[model samples]
Target: MTEKKNAAAIRGPSDHTIRDQIVAAAMEYFSHYGFEKTTVSDLARSIGFSKAYIYKFFGSKQEIGEVICASCLADITERLNAALEKSPSATEKIRQLFQTLAVAGCELFFRERRLYDIAAASSREHWPAAVQYEAALRERVLAILLEGRTAGEFERKTPLDETAMAVYLVLRPLADPLQLQISLDTAGEDANQLAALVLRSLTP
Candidate 1:
């Protein structure tokens, strides 16, 4: 086994902590320099560690990006879960979700846009973390849909999973920087119109 892996095996508690340090450093580099331009060497130098040492925890730059993006996804999931506890109608919850994404998501993913490239790259690479993140997103949507269906707020004719996936896809572009940039002025109107359409479709 690799020395770093061997060391991690010996110190189980510290293993994940040390890896988090590397991920934190990589996020800084990725923020300053787009993911395509940030090299493993840059990340190593930033943390005062050898490139080989960084590899002990992360196999590649893509893995670092994947992990970081996954964390972001997880954070989003937590917020959504917290909102779910308020027991809002599923339609209202979904409407609030789209509004939040249209505004906050655009601001973070487009206006700030530092880590946007990493997310896009992760999607392109088809990394497992990227896939997991998407599944998590779909799951969130699914939860909302199932809740609405159970409450009789939504059409029973539609399949829950497929409807959830459709909702995710429909709202995805509003959060996409490229799409937002192309038609910035109309994004708000577009988001509202789309949300209305989706919510209308959900009503029985």
Candidate 2:
């Protein structure tokens, strides 16, 4: 028992490495068991370290959930940016953005139901990281709209910023996890049709 406890107490080579491991392990547990079910001691045991070690990196389990939520959104944003880079037209880019977000949101949020719980908790906790990610999302949508206007792919009857905001709001449901799930479950609306409708609304 003494040897076992000592073995669990061993730290990783460095703080960064240890922190990454903790986050990675937490992600697995959170995905499989859920944020509410996973505990600090559980995480520590999984990483072969003490709860104190996890504390050295994260203040609490909620912090780990926040990081996971933020990381998931960051990944989605990267995919959206990549879609923009590869597509030929602003219209195509807009379509790609919706498709990308729809798939990514479903995979990330729906793949693990617990992630949705974490997201909800983060919202209630007022985690600024999630809020910042959403703000960045709005900005990216605005950028895509401005690009479309410049290329004459889309018309802007409203002010540029207003139009962008409106577009974001209108299309947001398709990307929202709960809304996306509901739409898929009840309406059987795939991402392709959804993307097309959004693109059609902006057609010149």
Candidate 3:
């Protein structure tokens, strides 16, 4: 009943604009004050909106965080796709994938530390945005493996799904927002070495 009401509240004629404004303001506020420190009331005041009005658009602070997290993850995905497109082969695509993710993770960690915290929280909590990001990333790895096999560049004996899962797991530390922070110092080197190891194993 309450969930239904909230869903209905989020779908009015002005909902899109209002919701985007609230989220945009929340992003800036949270980026400066930190997501953990900012409350709905604080965001409301900063954005010149009543707390109740803000709630009409977002069920909770976490919901707002979800939008911001999704946007950030989308940007990372865009960079990864762009890097892969520039690669000459599936082997190069796999290498670029790891390198792009590592570099993007490090950039976010240092340049947008507070926004990164929201992403870390989303990852830790298994928010829908984070879950979707992981699924898409796995699909990308699976696609790359399939491409390599078809090109006669990789072994076809191993099950593609299993191989993709293994590759995703190998890259998880660098790809995971929380884990990336812990391994920041060595993440780039780790990504390069792991990519090489994975490429060697994938060879026919």
Per-residue C-alpha lDDT of model 1 across residues 1-204, encoded as one tens digit per residue? 011122223322348778888877777877888889988998899899999887777667776776676665555555555665664688888876666555654555764367866656666676665566556667778888888889998998877777888999997776544454555567777778888999998889
Native-structure RMSD, model 1: 5.3
Candidate 3 lDDT over residue span 22-119, tens digit each = 87898899879999999999999998989988777677898888878888888898899889999989999989999999999999989989999999
| Per-model tally of clashing residue pairs | 0, 0, 0
Report the number of the highest-lDDT candidate: 3
Q: Ranking under lDDT, best-scoring first?
A: 3, 2, 1
Model 3 reaches what TM-score against the true structure? 0.92
Runs off by more than 4 Å, candidate 2: 1-14, 123-126, 186-190
* Model 3 spans with C-alpha error above 4 angstroms: 1-13
Q: Supply candidate 2's per-residue lDDT for 51.
A: 94
Tens digits of per-residue lDDT, candidate 2, 32-147, equal 78888888999899879899867766777877776677766667778888888999988888778777877777776557778877765665565765566656668878888889
| Overall lDDT per candidate, in order of appearance | 0.70, 0.71, 0.87
Show the lowest summed lDDT stretch of 10 residues, model 2.
1-10
